[model samples]
Target: MTKAERALETRERILKAACEVIADIGFENVSMRKVAEHAGVSKALLHYHFDTREKLFAEAMTHSFAQTGTDLDGGDADVPAGVLLARIVRTMLPTDEELRQDWKLWQELWVRAQRDDAARHLAVDLYDQLHAWVGGAVERGVASGEFAPCDVAAISTLILALCDGLGIRVMLADPRVDLSTAQSTIWSAIAPSLGISPAFPET
Candidate 1:
């Protein structure tokens, strides 16, 4: 790889390490030294690449949701929008070992954001992406007559708030918080609000 590519890779490595450390521990407990150690890089190198811990954490949040970037940006909805929407809805449900780590990391970030402005900014960005995706879907649903003529923006914001709030609720509760059930419940609630039968499949 070229120098530029190598530098980018190293930067990503540091961010991932920082995210994992914060996930394993709490963000309040995280240190640049710890992240450097986790990345197997030197402290000087961490500072050289990111300059500050907040920047590293912010970049990590972006990297964490990189896979959803296209959809979150309101690009073309993935085919079979219902299935895609359902999949996105299920993002909060971490069933496997790997996903559980991602979930824990985000949970840590959320708690940290309560006090840290940088963390709060990251939280806002996350919700904004979800708003764009859900709002686009709602607009399309209205155009297709699948939903009643309603305020797409408001409904989208409501969906995001519900989804995000419920995720936090489940995270704090006992292990029995069934995310699948939560997804289903939200969908049912949304269907009626959009003037569709709960059983009606998306067009």
Candidate 2:
């Protein structure tokens, strides 16, 4: 690889190390030195890549989701719109091992969002991506006659809000909330909005 490519790889390594460190420990307990050690690099090199711990943590959140294939920026293009939507819902169930880690990382980011502008912006940006993903699927479904006419934007926002709320319940270990309940509730709630039966074959 060229020098530039090598540098990019090193930067990615540092970010992945930061994610692993934070995932292993709580975010509040993470340190740049710890991340550097985790990455097998020197503290100075870690600082060279990311000047502040907050910045590193913020970027790490993006890296973490991307690695898990849960960013949902461009889901399977070959699948039907409904199947793609169902796949998205399934990934967010938090029952899978990687997704469960994502939920824990998200919990930390959500708390940080309240006190940090950078964290808040990252959270908003991810949510917007999610909104677009759902909205695009709904539009495609309507155009293909798979769904009925409805307010696309409003339904998109509502779906996100509902998942966010229910996901929180699952994360909080609410006595009544489990992965199956969360997944089924969200699928049932959203399916009708698309003018389809409340059940879709699991992707």
- Which 10-residue window in model 1 sums to the lowest lDDT? 67-76
lDDT of 1: 0.71
Weakest ten-residue segment in model 2 by summed lDDT:
69-78
Please give, for residues 1-203, the per-residue lDDT of candidate 2 as tens digits. 99999889999999878877787898999999999999999999999989998889888998876765453436455567777677677665566767777878888899999998989999999888878877887898788888888899988887777677888887778979887787778778877767787864566
How many collisions per candidate? 0, 0
Which residue pairs collide in model 2, if any? none
Candidate with maximal TM-score: 2
Off by over 4 Å in 2: 68-76
| Per-model TM-score on C-alpha atoms | 0.81, 0.89
Cα shift from native, residue 143, model 1 (Å): 2.9
Model 1 Cα lDDT, one tens digit per residue, 9-112:
99889978977887788777889999999999999989998888778877777777664434532555445445444556666455444556667777777887
